[model samples]
Target: MDSIQMFLANCNLSVSQAMRKIDSNSHGILFLVDDNNLLVGCVTDGDIRRYLLSGGGMSDVVARASNQKPKVARSLAEAIKLYHNRDYVVIPIINNQGIVIDMYMGEGVKDKKYSPLHLPVVINAGGKGTRLDPFTRVLPKPLIPVGDLPIIELIMQEYQSYSCDEFHIIVNYKRELMKAYFADNEANYNITWYDEEKPLGTGGGLSLLRGKLKSTFFFANCDALLTANYESMLKFHKDNGNVITMICAYKNINIPYGVVEMGENGVITDMKEKPLISFLTNTGIYIVEPEVIDDIGDEEAIGFPDIIEREKQKGKKVAVFPVSENDWMDMGQLPELEKMRKKLFGE
Candidate 1:
């Protein structure tokens, strides 16, 4: 099979099977073809998401979720024109028979337009980072190098892409190094540094700015880099009137090999060759309102999840914004450092 073949899916395939094709393409799109290899429809990344959110099952045929009418070009000239003139990132070139022959995937397209959010960002950089002990012994985890730039810098740059510049960083362990590193950097970031007098947990340090923040803000861990759109997250928070919106990603766990389920007396009940299970996990990034700060007791040590749970118990609106698994880069573990580097630089 050729490179473009990865982007083609059978119309009869299950939604999960089509999802695997979409993942392989890495462009969040699939061209659906019938048995005769003629394009029947298209499924973009958002299509499956909508299908799932609308109570559609993953085991159903993808034909049920695909757009029956998809944009296609019958000639090279038409394909180029469509690629440049519209927001569509990928366009399929098809012959008179509607068989896909070529593709215009990248380049010559307009840059992604992002509206200014102007939200404040708070980074919790205070932990001792015992997870990365040896490295944390040498340098703060926030300063740990993912590539040429430090992890903290990468986190800030992603937010900067959405026009969020104001930052509040809470620091404790090796704080002087964290402050000095940013102070001497030429980027000249506008930052307000908060010191934890004692070891305050993730949500505890946020209390330092209890009365200062007047609007919604972005809160994140220093080690997590999210490539998803920040503007969409903010819109969801405000549109749903949620006091807190936790950004999460679906993690797909694939179990290979035939597995059997047994009943009493070890009788075989059922079996499957392989299974793919997906679970949504927190990415440690959040859209938060200022009022949440006042809810935290000053200098109390509590993880952010616990704090959010407390607010939920009080009947506050806390929602979740889901993104795909590949959108998040976690630098907390030692093994993930190289993975994150390769992801950002494609080394």
Candidate 2:
């Protein structure tokens, strides 16, 4: 931020105002101060999201969504220790008088993006990439360039950050080219390649590895990348006893016109100007148990969502792990490829 003021907000600000400030600060958080400039509480974009999801409106006062007991430091030295010990992005340094003095951004966790999760990952790269059209005619979707590296490589490197080095890639269209590119590359990826003789839709390829994966593994689509904390996701899946945990992203979309809701006979019960709709969209990423792979029926065409539904119907513990909207990136389309390029490489 240009100044520390961007991270500081008056405790009386509205939720929408705090949301905008947090967006501008790019830290997803803000420290709120009272009239006397005393630290009152802290609010984060996540707090606002939970509020909205729980039927709270954006026009509500931010204090209603604030965490009353926020973690703060008395000195920079203490802030640095707290910053590393806890994964806090920003910590406010306050005086004994309970007045806001300074803010500290520490150093340690900045260099290390992720800890070791040590899980195996399965990448579904079998699609024909028809959406990409002419480009798909030559190079496969997995080999499509996002920045300097292919999208699949970027996806793999993301998993590698958590020490999940083992990869199982299911390839169909242009399988030979996909294999050839990795065969000569020196990234030294421990990859097991699976071939689908007939085009099996998203989840069908798992049938090929029915007996292979013995433990928990990540299942991902090559066209999208997820930046959520892998360790936390794994813990949630295990603690919840979920056989499949589909990673979802909170997507916020704004309506251009006034949204109206009618109760009966042209009687408008509720109306809002330019309403923002929130949805938990699937990010095409999953943490799956061995049972899920074994449950794959046949060499039939089936999307992953259908598989999840089938498991849900069978009373299997299927769950969802949600991340912020910015954490997921999809490069399935030509237009989104540019967005992905800028997000990954700042081009």
Candidate 3:
């Protein structure tokens, strides 16, 4: 249980202060306290937005833009239940004196029991590595060494950090090699094999295990290394009623030449020189509901994105969360793989 001092606002705080408090606390809420260290009211992003949208001034007192009585819970289960009920980012816990004693965050809860976090993950390890060429000719891309460890082993370790143990590796090209390597290593993760006799596209192999999984799980391409809080991602997926949640990364594309935005009559609305363009690109990581397995076609080449888009057309909620740029490492090409080796091994 952690809390902020109520009477510490000797100086005026900005909206950015509130945002920082919310983020640091992981609850998406901040409390406005009085001189006696008593809770005056609580401020949320929505509350601030409402005041701003209603033409309220930024210099107004925080108490004027807060909720009088915020929803709260005493125990962990009740807190989780409240988190599932409302879209609140944080819940404040106050004692009889109306002073905030604790704060419960919605994004940092780990499953105490094995049930929620132990979903069956699918690893798409079937891609033909033409990019790495000669090196991949002898080794499957999944088994390619990132440092002293295989690429897929590092990926599994990342998921294991978040308590995910059950894994399903989809194998096609050099399936026996992957199995033999895993058999040689005395690893402890529970991995089930899904062997494709013929070459199936990345998403097509997942259909082979359609009936094998029964809980919300994750899927990833074996080549990309991403570091993210999987528990927070899963909670976001379930709390928002989303059937599928794709993890995206902010990628910047540099323009060598000057860029300009022109209007209909060729008038330059805005002009800039070699500005960097940023966009969210898929990191090939996803959390998907179990029922989506029923949507997998019986064809040999159906892809996961195509099936997800079809579900979206049928009104299923699909969400996306962004990750940091430095956190995503793709070992698909020789140059990138070399960079990863240097970063991992400090060579």
Best by TM-score: 1
Candidate number with greatest lDDT: 1
Tens-place lDDT per residue, model 2, 98-146, is 8868878775436656778888899999999999999999999999988
Give the deviation of candidate 1 from the true structure as CA RMSD: 2.0
Q: Rank by TM-score, descending?
A: 1, 2, 3
lDDT of each: 0.88, 0.86, 0.73
Write candidate 3's Cα lDDT for 1-347 as tens digits. 32454212312455434534444454345677677766666776456545654665444565666776767666657777887787655565667776667666666664432224776689989878889898889999999998899999999987876678889998888889999999888886689998877767767787788788888889898999876556667777898898889887655556898988999999889987976565567888888887777777664676667767978998999977655455578889999999888866888
Per-candidate TM-scores read 0.93, 0.86, 0.66
lDDT of 1 by residue, 53-171 (tens): 67777678999999999999888788889977887767888888889998887565456678899999999999988899899998999999987999999999888888999999999
Q: Record all residue pairs in model 1 with backbone atoms less than 3 Å apart, i.e. clashing.
A: none
Better of 2 and 3 by TM-score: 2
Task: Identify the runs in model 1 with alpha carbons over 4 angstroms from their true place.
Answer: 14-17, 57-60, 106-110
User: For model 1, what is the alpha-carbon lDDT of residue 265?
Assistant: 100
Cα lDDT, model 1, residue 174: 97
Q: What's the distance in Å from true for residue 300, model 2?
A: 2.3
